[model samples]
Target: MEKQILDFSLVPLGLCLLLAYHIWLLHRIIKHPTSTILGINGVNRQVWVRTMMEDVSKNGILAVQTLRNNIMASTVLASTAIMLSSVLSIIMANSKARPSEIVLGAESELGFWIKFLSILVCFLMAFLFNIQCIRYYSHASMLINVPVKKMSSSHLRAEYVKRTVNRGSCFWSLGLRAFYFSLPLFFWLFGPIPMFLCCVVLVFMLYFLDVTFDYGGVVDEEEEW
Candidate 1:
């Protein structure tokens, strides 16, 4: 038997796996040598650019470049996906039964366009998310190249403090990451409460992830894209 989206178990199982994966991945980064995936030296690096690159697992200009690529991919795919979704909405709006009609007259243009849009949206969304992941990976890379000369005890201690704050981002980014792979349940729109909550939570996650790391450290001077 083929599985259908209407089947109840699949959604929960998928979310559970996603949640668990994020929890585990966070644990790994927190315990890593840099307390981040990309190696940026916090000691002498500039704060803002370093932070951005480190978040992407890239350093300096490289991270921005990575972001540029991601933005492009996301724009293309997201636009296409939205277009498809819009078309589908248009379709469901115009469906009318024509049981008496034969052959070419049977299928309505409205229904076909709607179905086609829904399918096209699915493809676009998938591609968009794939490139988004590179965003996180490049951020992690920014932390991979720190030059460890002696820093004041205070600076080192701050690093630990920063790590604790970054943990929250870990959870949030992981959740946002989940959206990349999670099925686009368009019907969920009917239940406004849940969908709104999910979006709110995601926004909070990205916000925390950004703020937590923004001031803490910078990538090494030598490390540029």
Candidate 2:
């Protein structure tokens, strides 16, 4: 029994380490976006928007359409997050509805509920961040195509538009990260071993998804602008 306890303890320890590593990586990306794939993509996106805004004569139509698409996409994600949160809350409220028992054939009530709560938090955060993303996007859409004049106000509006869109993108990325984190938590309901393995796999998947091929080129161009 001692040995079994020791083995089980390692599972939570490994999970904690994995979560810490994930958080550290995100912090690094935020601090130095050009160093990571996802960060680089974000930089590129900002550059693209700024470039389009600077040359409204040639890109005005495309910019408006892109912002509209972004708003639509954010809306869909927000709705999905809300639905998932609702479902999870209902499941969590039912004491007898243990996921471990249903999915893993285990009678570990405590572990099952813990896992459920983790998943629930992920969905709730995703929902909240997605709503914020939608708010920024909505505000950005109105400013993105505003008529450019030789006035200082026009330049300020352009700057605000870029900042708003960038903020929206950040929130959207965070919502997606919450979704990614939930995958491992869901597998955790089955067993710690699977959870650990899923965490490793998720790190690899996120690394690939977040890293961009353009490197620091986009960031450099934005700086020059």
lDDT of every predicted structure (CA atoms)? 0.41, 0.74
TM-score each candidate: 0.32, 0.81
Using TM-score as the measure, the top candidate is 2
lDDT of 1 by residue, 39-136 (tens): 23222223433364243334545644644564455455545555655765555455473322311221345434443454445545554454444444
Candidate 2 per-residue C-alpha lDDT over 1-225 given as tens digits, one digit per residue, 9 for 90 to 100: 553463387567756766787787777676656767666656667677778888788888888788788878878888898899898888777778546646573446666667678888898899898889988888877677666774568767766776788889889988988988788788766666777788787777766766654554235544321
Q: Give residue 137's lDDT in candidate 2 (0 to 100).
A: 82
Residue 87 accuracy (lDDT) in model 2: 88
